[model samples]
Target: MNIKDYLESGTLEAFVLGSASAAEADELQQLKVKHPEIGYALDAIEADLEMIAQHMAIMPPPGMLERIEDRIHELKRHPVAERLPDQLRDHGQRSEKDKGQYIEVEGASSHMRIHKIWRWIFAAVFILGKIFLGFAIYFYLENRQAREEVKELKREIRQHHTIIGQQ
Candidate 1:
Protein backbone atom coordinates (compact mmCIF):
# COMPACT_ATOMS: atom_id res chain seq x y z
CA MET A 1 0.00 0.00 0.00
CA ASN A 2 1.20 3.51 -0.78
CA ILE A 3 2.50 5.12 2.44
CA LYS A 4 1.09 8.56 1.60
CA ASP A 5 -2.37 7.16 0.86
CA TYR A 6 -2.38 5.05 4.03
CA LEU A 7 -1.31 8.01 6.18
CA GLU A 8 -3.99 10.23 4.65
CA SER A 9 -6.72 7.56 5.15
CA GLY A 10 -6.97 8.50 8.88
CA THR A 11 -6.18 4.96 10.07
CA LEU A 12 -3.31 6.33 12.12
CA GLU A 13 -5.64 8.84 13.81
CA ALA A 14 -8.14 6.07 14.53
CA PHE A 15 -5.34 3.93 15.98
CA VAL A 16 -4.07 6.79 18.14
CA LEU A 17 -7.57 7.42 19.51
CA GLY A 18 -8.09 3.64 20.13
CA SER A 19 -11.03 3.55 17.72
CA ALA A 20 -9.27 1.17 15.29
CA SER A 21 -10.74 -2.29 14.79
CA ALA A 22 -8.62 -5.35 15.70
CA ALA A 23 -7.87 -6.11 12.03
CA GLU A 24 -6.86 -2.49 11.37
CA ALA A 25 -4.63 -2.46 14.47
CA ASP A 26 -2.93 -5.68 13.33
CA GLU A 27 -2.29 -4.16 9.91
CA LEU A 28 -0.92 -0.96 11.52
CA GLN A 29 1.45 -2.92 13.81
CA GLN A 30 2.71 -5.00 10.87
CA LEU A 31 3.25 -1.87 8.78
CA LYS A 32 5.06 -0.18 11.66
CA VAL A 33 7.42 -3.15 11.96
CA LYS A 34 8.11 -3.40 8.21
CA HIS A 35 8.50 0.35 7.50
CA PRO A 36 10.48 2.80 9.62
CA GLU A 37 8.51 5.72 8.10
CA ILE A 38 5.22 4.39 9.53
CA GLY A 39 6.77 4.18 12.99
CA TYR A 40 8.14 7.74 12.68
CA ALA A 41 4.78 8.99 11.49
CA LEU A 42 2.95 7.40 14.44
CA ASP A 43 5.44 8.92 16.86
CA ALA A 44 5.05 12.32 15.21
CA ILE A 45 1.24 12.15 15.48
CA GLU A 46 1.42 11.15 19.15
CA ALA A 47 3.77 14.06 19.92
CA ASP A 48 1.48 16.43 18.08
CA LEU A 49 -1.49 15.23 20.14
CA GLU A 50 0.52 15.74 23.31
CA MET A 51 1.42 19.25 22.28
CA ILE A 52 -2.21 20.02 21.49
CA ALA A 53 -3.29 18.70 24.88
CA GLN A 54 -0.65 20.80 26.68
CA HIS A 55 -1.82 23.93 24.89
CA MET A 56 -5.45 23.19 25.75
CA ALA A 57 -4.79 22.10 29.32
CA ILE A 58 -6.93 23.68 32.05
CA MET A 59 -5.79 24.10 35.65
CA PRO A 60 -7.44 21.69 38.05
CA PRO A 61 -9.26 23.00 41.13
CA PRO A 62 -7.12 23.66 44.21
CA GLY A 63 -6.32 20.59 46.38
CA MET A 64 -7.30 18.25 43.53
CA LEU A 65 -3.89 16.58 43.72
CA GLU A 66 -4.23 16.13 47.48
CA ARG A 67 -7.67 14.57 47.03
CA ILE A 68 -6.31 12.28 44.31
CA GLU A 69 -3.37 11.24 46.49
CA ASP A 70 -5.72 10.58 49.42
CA ARG A 71 -7.84 8.37 47.16
CA ILE A 72 -4.74 6.51 45.92
CA HIS A 73 -3.64 5.94 49.50
CA GLU A 74 -7.11 4.68 50.42
CA LEU A 75 -7.09 2.26 47.50
CA LYS A 76 -3.62 1.07 48.46
CA ARG A 77 -4.70 0.49 52.06
CA HIS A 78 -7.56 -1.86 51.14
CA PRO A 79 -6.62 -3.80 48.05
CA VAL A 80 -9.54 -5.07 46.00
CA ALA A 81 -9.59 -8.49 44.33
CA GLU A 82 -8.29 -8.77 40.79
CA ARG A 83 -11.12 -9.00 38.29
CA LEU A 84 -11.32 -11.10 35.15
CA PRO A 85 -10.96 -8.71 32.23
CA ASP A 86 -13.98 -8.14 30.00
CA GLN A 87 -12.48 -10.06 27.08
CA LEU A 88 -11.38 -12.96 29.29
CA ARG A 89 -14.77 -13.35 31.03
CA ASP A 90 -16.17 -16.79 30.28
CA HIS A 91 -19.37 -16.70 28.24
CA GLY A 92 -20.31 -20.11 29.62
CA GLN A 93 -20.36 -18.68 33.14
CA ARG A 94 -22.76 -15.91 32.18
CA SER A 95 -26.51 -16.49 32.32
CA GLU A 96 -28.54 -16.18 29.12
CA LYS A 97 -29.91 -12.80 30.28
CA ASP A 98 -26.37 -11.45 30.91
CA LYS A 99 -24.83 -12.80 27.68
CA GLY A 100 -24.84 -9.45 25.86
CA GLN A 101 -24.40 -7.18 28.90
CA TYR A 102 -21.71 -6.63 31.52
CA ILE A 103 -22.08 -8.43 34.86
CA GLU A 104 -21.50 -6.88 38.29
CA VAL A 105 -18.66 -8.34 40.35
CA GLU A 106 -18.88 -8.76 44.13
CA GLY A 107 -16.23 -7.11 46.27
CA ALA A 108 -14.35 -8.65 49.21
CA SER A 109 -16.89 -7.27 51.69
CA SER A 110 -20.60 -6.60 51.25
CA HIS A 111 -20.47 -3.76 53.81
CA MET A 112 -19.26 -0.31 52.77
CA ARG A 113 -15.99 0.85 54.27
CA ILE A 114 -15.32 4.50 55.12
CA HIS A 115 -12.24 6.59 55.79
CA LYS A 116 -10.86 6.88 59.36
CA ILE A 117 -11.55 10.61 59.40
CA TRP A 118 -15.24 9.95 58.65
CA ARG A 119 -15.48 7.42 61.47
CA TRP A 120 -14.29 10.02 63.97
CA ILE A 121 -16.67 12.61 62.58
CA PHE A 122 -19.58 10.13 62.78
CA ALA A 123 -18.73 9.30 66.39
CA ALA A 124 -18.59 12.97 67.32
CA VAL A 125 -21.96 13.61 65.67
CA PHE A 126 -23.54 10.62 67.44
CA ILE A 127 -22.25 11.76 70.83
CA LEU A 128 -23.46 15.32 70.22
CA GLY A 129 -26.90 13.98 69.19
CA LYS A 130 -27.18 11.98 72.41
CA ILE A 131 -26.19 15.00 74.50
CA PHE A 132 -28.81 17.14 72.74
CA LEU A 133 -31.43 14.43 73.38
CA GLY A 134 -30.55 14.44 77.08
CA PHE A 135 -30.87 18.22 77.23
CA ALA A 136 -34.27 18.01 75.54
CA ILE A 137 -35.51 15.47 78.06
CA TYR A 138 -34.23 17.53 80.99
CA PHE A 139 -35.93 20.71 79.69
CA TYR A 140 -39.20 18.79 79.14
CA LEU A 141 -39.22 17.56 82.76
CA GLU A 142 -38.46 21.05 84.13
CA ASN A 143 -41.33 22.51 82.09
CA ARG A 144 -43.72 19.83 83.38
CA GLN A 145 -42.73 20.60 87.00
CA ALA A 146 -43.32 24.34 86.44
CA ARG A 147 -46.79 23.62 84.96
CA GLU A 148 -47.80 21.53 88.03
CA GLU A 149 -46.68 24.34 90.40
CA VAL A 150 -48.79 26.87 88.46
CA LYS A 151 -51.88 24.62 88.76
CA GLU A 152 -51.32 24.29 92.54
CA LEU A 153 -51.01 28.10 92.89
CA LYS A 154 -54.35 28.57 91.05
CA ARG A 155 -56.08 26.11 93.40
CA GLU A 156 -54.70 27.92 96.51
CA ILE A 157 -55.94 31.31 95.13
CA ARG A 158 -59.47 29.87 94.63
CA GLN A 159 -59.51 28.42 98.17
CA HIS A 160 -58.40 31.76 99.67
CA HIS A 161 -61.17 33.66 97.76
CA THR A 162 -63.83 31.23 99.18
CA ILE A 163 -62.47 31.66 102.71
CA ILE A 164 -62.49 35.51 102.39
CA GLY A 165 -66.12 35.43 101.03
CA GLN A 166 -67.33 33.25 103.93
CA GLN A 167 -65.77 35.59 106.53
Candidate 2:
Protein backbone atom coordinates (compact mmCIF):
# COMPACT_ATOMS: atom_id res chain seq x y z
CA MET A 1 0.00 0.00 0.00
CA ASN A 2 1.37 3.39 -1.10
CA ILE A 3 1.85 5.72 1.93
CA LYS A 4 0.66 8.75 -0.04
CA ASP A 5 -2.47 6.92 -1.17
CA TYR A 6 -3.23 5.87 2.39
CA LEU A 7 -2.72 9.44 3.60
CA GLU A 8 -5.25 10.83 1.07
CA SER A 9 -7.80 8.03 1.58
CA GLY A 10 -9.67 10.06 4.26
CA THR A 11 -8.98 7.34 6.87
CA LEU A 12 -6.71 9.65 8.81
CA GLU A 13 -9.28 12.49 8.68
CA ALA A 14 -12.02 10.17 9.95
CA PHE A 15 -9.76 8.96 12.76
CA VAL A 16 -8.88 12.52 13.79
CA LEU A 17 -12.56 13.51 13.69
CA GLY A 18 -13.51 10.49 15.85
CA SER A 19 -15.91 9.20 13.17
CA ALA A 20 -13.81 6.15 12.29
CA SER A 21 -15.17 2.67 13.12
CA ALA A 22 -13.53 0.55 15.78
CA ALA A 23 -11.77 -1.60 13.16
CA GLU A 24 -10.57 1.47 11.24
CA ALA A 25 -9.33 3.05 14.49
CA ASP A 26 -7.32 -0.07 15.35
CA GLU A 27 -5.75 -0.11 11.86
CA LEU A 28 -4.93 3.62 12.08
CA GLN A 29 -3.18 3.12 15.43
CA GLN A 30 -1.04 0.37 13.95
CA LEU A 31 -0.17 2.51 10.93
CA LYS A 32 0.66 5.50 13.20
CA VAL A 33 3.24 3.36 15.05
CA LYS A 34 4.86 2.14 11.84
CA HIS A 35 4.87 5.57 10.12
CA PRO A 36 5.98 8.87 11.67
CA GLU A 37 4.33 10.86 8.86
CA ILE A 38 0.88 9.52 9.86
CA GLY A 39 1.41 10.82 13.39
CA TYR A 40 2.49 14.25 12.09
CA ALA A 41 -0.51 14.42 9.78
CA LEU A 42 -2.83 13.52 12.67
CA ASP A 43 -1.30 16.26 14.82
CA ALA A 44 -1.70 18.88 12.07
CA ILE A 45 -5.32 17.86 11.49
CA GLU A 46 -6.09 18.03 15.23
CA ALA A 47 -4.51 21.51 15.49
CA ASP A 48 -6.55 22.71 12.50
CA LEU A 49 -9.73 21.36 14.11
CA GLU A 50 -8.87 23.13 17.40
CA MET A 51 -8.26 26.44 15.60
CA ILE A 52 -11.55 26.08 13.75
CA ALA A 53 -13.42 25.39 17.00
CA GLN A 54 -11.83 28.41 18.70
CA HIS A 55 -12.82 30.67 15.83
CA MET A 56 -16.42 29.40 15.87
CA ALA A 57 -16.88 29.35 19.64
CA ILE A 58 -19.69 31.53 21.00
CA MET A 59 -20.76 32.29 24.57
CA PRO A 60 -24.27 31.16 25.43
CA PRO A 61 -26.75 33.44 27.25
CA PRO A 62 -26.26 33.58 31.00
CA GLY A 63 -28.52 31.29 33.07
CA MET A 64 -29.20 29.07 30.06
CA LEU A 65 -27.81 26.02 31.81
CA GLU A 66 -29.61 26.94 35.02
CA ARG A 67 -32.92 27.32 33.23
CA ILE A 68 -32.47 23.93 31.56
CA GLU A 69 -31.66 22.25 34.87
CA ASP A 70 -34.57 23.96 36.61
CA ARG A 71 -36.94 22.77 33.88
CA ILE A 72 -35.57 19.22 34.23
CA HIS A 73 -36.17 19.33 37.99
CA GLU A 74 -39.69 20.66 37.50
CA LEU A 75 -40.44 17.84 35.09
CA LYS A 76 -39.08 15.32 37.57
CA ARG A 77 -41.20 16.84 40.34
CA HIS A 78 -44.36 16.56 38.21
CA PRO A 79 -44.05 13.14 36.65
CA VAL A 80 -46.84 11.78 34.42
CA ALA A 81 -48.99 9.12 36.08
CA GLU A 82 -51.97 7.07 34.95
CA ARG A 83 -55.19 8.57 36.23
CA LEU A 84 -57.51 6.42 38.29
CA PRO A 85 -60.90 5.82 36.65
CA ASP A 86 -64.09 7.04 38.37
CA GLN A 87 -65.15 3.46 39.15
CA LEU A 88 -61.76 2.72 40.71
CA ARG A 89 -62.00 5.62 43.19
CA ASP A 90 -63.41 4.91 46.70
CA HIS A 91 -66.20 7.49 46.81
CA GLY A 92 -67.32 6.40 50.33
CA GLN A 93 -63.96 7.49 51.82
CA ARG A 94 -63.91 10.90 50.01
CA SER A 95 -64.69 14.15 51.87
CA GLU A 96 -67.15 16.82 50.65
CA LYS A 97 -64.41 18.63 48.70
CA ASP A 98 -62.83 15.38 47.46
CA LYS A 99 -66.25 14.01 46.29
CA GLY A 100 -65.93 15.97 43.03
CA GLN A 101 -64.92 14.43 39.69
CA TYR A 102 -61.30 15.38 40.25
CA ILE A 103 -59.08 12.72 41.78
CA GLU A 104 -56.89 13.86 44.68
CA VAL A 105 -53.26 13.38 43.77
CA GLU A 106 -50.96 12.41 46.65
CA GLY A 107 -47.45 13.93 46.99
CA ALA A 108 -48.32 16.58 44.39
CA SER A 109 -50.16 19.81 45.12
CA SER A 110 -52.97 20.97 42.83
CA HIS A 111 -52.49 24.63 43.72
CA MET A 112 -48.97 25.85 42.88
CA ARG A 113 -47.87 29.19 44.32
CA ILE A 114 -44.42 30.73 44.62
CA HIS A 115 -43.37 32.07 48.03
CA LYS A 116 -43.74 35.84 48.61
CA ILE A 117 -40.03 36.00 49.39
CA TRP A 118 -39.34 34.45 45.99
CA ARG A 119 -40.96 37.48 44.33
CA TRP A 120 -38.26 39.67 45.82
CA ILE A 121 -35.61 37.11 45.03
CA PHE A 122 -36.76 36.89 41.39
CA ALA A 123 -36.57 40.71 41.05
CA ALA A 124 -33.08 40.70 42.50
CA VAL A 125 -32.05 37.89 40.19
CA PHE A 126 -33.36 39.79 37.16
CA ILE A 127 -31.51 42.97 38.12
CA LEU A 128 -28.29 41.08 38.81
CA GLY A 129 -28.67 39.18 35.53
CA LYS A 130 -28.79 42.45 33.59
CA ILE A 131 -25.76 43.75 35.46
CA PHE A 132 -23.80 40.56 34.79
CA LEU A 133 -24.81 40.62 31.11
CA GLY A 134 -23.50 44.17 30.78
CA PHE A 135 -20.21 43.24 32.42
CA ALA A 136 -19.87 40.13 30.25
CA ILE A 137 -20.34 42.17 27.06
CA TYR A 138 -17.84 44.77 28.26
CA PHE A 139 -15.21 42.14 29.11
CA TYR A 140 -15.76 40.19 25.89
CA LEU A 141 -15.14 43.28 23.77
CA GLU A 142 -12.09 44.22 25.90
CA ASN A 143 -10.65 40.72 25.56
CA ARG A 144 -11.17 40.71 21.79
CA GLN A 145 -9.44 44.09 21.46
CA ALA A 146 -6.57 42.86 23.66
CA ARG A 147 -6.18 39.75 21.47
CA GLU A 148 -5.90 41.90 18.33
CA GLU A 149 -3.32 44.12 19.98
CA VAL A 150 -1.26 41.09 21.06
CA LYS A 151 -1.36 39.69 17.53
CA GLU A 152 -0.13 43.01 16.10
CA LEU A 153 2.69 43.14 18.65
CA LYS A 154 3.72 39.55 17.90
CA ARG A 155 3.79 40.24 14.16
CA GLU A 156 5.98 43.32 14.67
CA ILE A 157 8.33 41.36 16.94
CA ARG A 158 8.65 38.55 14.33
CA GLN A 159 9.45 41.09 11.61
CA HIS A 160 12.16 42.72 13.78
CA HIS A 161 13.62 39.29 14.61
CA THR A 162 13.75 38.30 10.93
CA ILE A 163 15.40 41.59 9.97
CA ILE A 164 18.06 41.16 12.68
CA GLY A 165 18.69 37.53 11.68
CA GLN A 166 19.17 38.51 8.00
CA GLN A 167 21.88 41.04 8.93
Candidate 3:
Protein backbone atom coordinates (compact mmCIF):
# COMPACT_ATOMS: atom_id res chain seq x y z
CA MET A 1 0.00 0.00 0.00
CA ASN A 2 1.00 3.60 -0.65
CA ILE A 3 1.76 5.88 2.31
CA LYS A 4 -1.77 7.36 2.32
CA ASP A 5 -3.38 3.92 2.19
CA TYR A 6 -1.00 2.54 4.78
CA LEU A 7 -1.63 5.39 7.23
CA GLU A 8 -5.39 5.48 6.58
CA SER A 9 -5.83 1.79 7.46
CA GLY A 10 -4.58 2.31 11.06
CA THR A 11 -1.95 -0.42 10.62
CA LEU A 12 0.83 1.91 11.77
CA GLU A 13 -0.91 2.57 15.08
CA ALA A 14 -1.45 -1.13 15.62
CA PHE A 15 2.16 -1.81 14.73
CA VAL A 16 3.21 0.92 17.15
CA LEU A 17 1.00 -0.69 19.78
CA GLY A 18 2.52 -4.11 19.04
CA SER A 19 -1.06 -5.28 18.55
CA ALA A 20 -0.67 -6.40 14.89
CA SER A 21 -1.36 -10.05 14.18
CA ALA A 22 1.48 -12.46 13.42
CA ALA A 23 0.47 -12.52 9.74
CA GLU A 24 0.57 -8.73 9.65
CA ALA A 25 3.97 -8.74 11.34
CA ASP A 26 5.40 -11.15 8.77
CA GLU A 27 4.00 -8.99 5.96
CA LEU A 28 5.43 -5.84 7.48
CA GLN A 29 8.77 -7.60 7.93
CA GLN A 30 8.81 -8.45 4.25
CA LEU A 31 7.90 -4.88 3.36
CA LYS A 32 10.73 -3.61 5.55
CA VAL A 33 13.21 -5.82 3.70
CA LYS A 34 11.93 -4.67 0.30
CA HIS A 35 11.75 -0.91 1.08
CA PRO A 36 13.95 1.39 3.20
CA GLU A 37 11.03 3.84 3.41
CA ILE A 38 8.98 1.30 5.29
CA GLY A 39 11.80 0.93 7.83
CA TYR A 40 11.94 4.71 8.24
CA ALA A 41 8.17 4.81 8.78
CA LEU A 42 8.43 2.08 11.38
CA ASP A 43 11.18 3.98 13.18
CA ALA A 44 9.06 7.13 13.16
CA ILE A 45 6.10 5.26 14.55
CA GLU A 46 8.27 3.71 17.28
CA ALA A 47 9.67 7.11 18.12
CA ASP A 48 6.14 8.44 18.58
CA LEU A 49 5.13 5.56 20.83
CA GLU A 50 8.36 5.77 22.80
CA MET A 51 7.58 9.42 23.40
CA ILE A 52 4.09 8.51 24.56
CA ALA A 53 5.34 5.84 26.97
CA GLN A 54 7.92 8.22 28.38
CA HIS A 55 5.30 10.92 28.90
CA MET A 56 2.88 8.57 30.65
CA ALA A 57 5.31 7.68 33.48
CA ILE A 58 5.31 9.82 36.58
CA MET A 59 5.71 9.39 40.36
CA PRO A 60 2.94 7.12 41.63
CA PRO A 61 0.65 7.78 44.57
CA PRO A 62 2.24 7.61 48.01
CA GLY A 63 2.21 4.02 49.34
CA MET A 64 0.10 2.97 46.35
CA LEU A 65 2.91 1.16 44.56
CA GLU A 66 3.82 -0.66 47.75
CA ARG A 67 0.19 -1.48 48.41
CA ILE A 68 -0.18 -2.83 44.86
CA GLU A 69 2.96 -4.90 45.22
CA ASP A 70 1.71 -6.29 48.52
CA ARG A 71 -1.64 -7.09 46.98
CA ILE A 72 0.07 -8.96 44.13
CA HIS A 73 1.98 -11.01 46.66
CA GLU A 74 -1.22 -11.70 48.56
CA LEU A 75 -2.91 -12.82 45.35
CA LYS A 76 -0.04 -15.15 44.56
CA ARG A 77 -0.14 -16.61 48.06
CA HIS A 78 -3.90 -17.09 48.13
CA PRO A 79 -6.00 -17.12 44.99
CA VAL A 80 -9.45 -15.81 45.76
CA ALA A 81 -12.61 -17.20 44.26
CA GLU A 82 -15.11 -14.75 42.84
CA ARG A 83 -18.25 -14.60 44.97
CA LEU A 84 -21.47 -13.54 43.29
CA PRO A 85 -24.90 -12.51 44.60
CA ASP A 86 -24.15 -9.89 47.22
CA GLN A 87 -25.85 -10.18 50.59
CA LEU A 88 -29.29 -8.62 50.63
CA ARG A 89 -30.75 -7.17 53.80
CA ASP A 90 -33.93 -5.27 54.55
CA HIS A 91 -33.35 -1.53 55.09
CA GLY A 92 -36.99 -0.68 55.84
CA GLN A 93 -37.03 -1.98 59.40
CA ARG A 94 -36.62 0.54 62.20
CA SER A 95 -36.10 -0.08 65.92
CA GLU A 96 -38.47 1.92 68.10
CA LYS A 97 -36.37 4.38 70.05
CA ASP A 98 -36.12 8.07 70.96
CA LYS A 99 -36.33 10.94 68.39
CA GLY A 100 -33.58 9.39 66.17
CA GLN A 101 -32.20 5.90 65.51
CA TYR A 102 -28.82 4.60 64.30
CA ILE A 103 -28.31 1.24 62.63
CA GLU A 104 -25.12 -0.65 61.93
CA VAL A 105 -24.86 -1.91 58.34
CA GLU A 106 -23.01 -5.14 59.25
CA GLY A 107 -21.27 -6.01 62.46
CA ALA A 108 -21.29 -8.44 65.37
CA SER A 109 -23.60 -6.27 67.43
CA SER A 110 -25.25 -2.83 67.18
CA HIS A 111 -27.18 -0.66 69.69
CA MET A 112 -28.30 2.93 69.40
CA ARG A 113 -27.30 5.48 72.08
CA ILE A 114 -27.07 9.28 71.93
CA HIS A 115 -23.47 10.44 71.81
CA LYS A 116 -22.18 13.69 70.26
CA ILE A 117 -18.51 12.55 70.23
CA TRP A 118 -19.22 9.36 68.25
CA ARG A 119 -21.11 11.32 65.57
CA TRP A 120 -18.22 13.76 65.16
CA ILE A 121 -15.70 10.90 64.99
CA PHE A 122 -17.67 9.07 62.27
CA ALA A 123 -18.10 12.24 60.23
CA ALA A 124 -14.41 13.04 60.50
CA VAL A 125 -13.38 9.57 59.31
CA PHE A 126 -15.81 9.69 56.37
CA ILE A 127 -14.51 13.07 55.17
CA LEU A 128 -10.87 12.00 55.47
CA GLY A 129 -11.49 8.77 53.62
CA LYS A 130 -13.12 10.67 50.74
CA ILE A 131 -10.22 13.08 50.48
CA PHE A 132 -7.63 10.28 50.60
CA LEU A 133 -9.40 8.26 47.90
CA GLY A 134 -9.82 11.31 45.66
CA PHE A 135 -6.14 12.24 45.82
CA ALA A 136 -5.04 8.67 45.25
CA ILE A 137 -6.99 8.48 41.98
CA TYR A 138 -5.85 11.91 40.84
CA PHE A 139 -2.20 11.14 41.52
CA TYR A 140 -2.25 7.87 39.60
CA LEU A 141 -3.89 9.42 36.53
CA GLU A 142 -1.62 12.45 36.52
CA ASN A 143 1.46 10.26 36.81
CA ARG A 144 0.35 8.05 33.93
CA GLN A 145 -0.57 11.03 31.69
CA ALA A 146 2.69 12.77 32.44
CA ARG A 147 4.59 9.74 31.18
CA GLU A 148 2.68 9.87 27.86
CA GLU A 149 3.33 13.60 27.53
CA VAL A 150 7.04 13.11 28.04
CA LYS A 151 7.09 10.45 25.33
CA GLU A 152 5.36 12.78 22.88
CA LEU A 153 7.86 15.55 23.57
CA LYS A 154 10.77 13.17 22.99
CA ARG A 155 9.25 12.04 19.70
CA GLU A 156 8.99 15.65 18.55
CA ILE A 157 12.64 16.17 19.42
CA ARG A 158 13.63 13.08 17.45
CA GLN A 159 11.58 14.31 14.50
CA HIS A 160 13.45 17.59 14.63
CA HIS A 161 16.75 15.72 14.74
CA THR A 162 15.74 13.71 11.69
CA ILE A 163 14.75 16.83 9.75
CA ILE A 164 17.97 18.67 10.64
CA GLY A 165 20.06 15.64 9.73
CA GLN A 166 18.32 15.49 6.36
CA GLN A 167 18.94 19.22 5.84
TM-score of 2: 0.38
Candidate achieving higher TM-score, 1 or 2: 1
* Candidate 1 lDDT tens digits, 51-75: 9999999999898898898768757
Sorting all predicted structures by lDDT, with the top scorer first, yields 1, 2, 3
Q: What lDDT is obtained when candidate 3 is compared to the true structure?
A: 0.72
Worst 10 residues of 3 by lDDT: 81-90
Better lDDT candidate (2, 3): 2
Best by TM-score: 1
TM-score of each: 0.46, 0.38, 0.36
- Cα lDDT tens digits for candidate 2, 62-125: 9889879876776777654434544355544655655656655554546464677999999999
TM-score quality measure for candidate 1: 0.46
Total clashes for model 1 = 0
- Order of candidates by TM-score, top first? 1, 2, 3
Better of 1 and 3 by TM-score: 1
**Candidate 2 lDDT for residue 53:** 97
Residue 18 in candidate 1 has what lDDT? 94
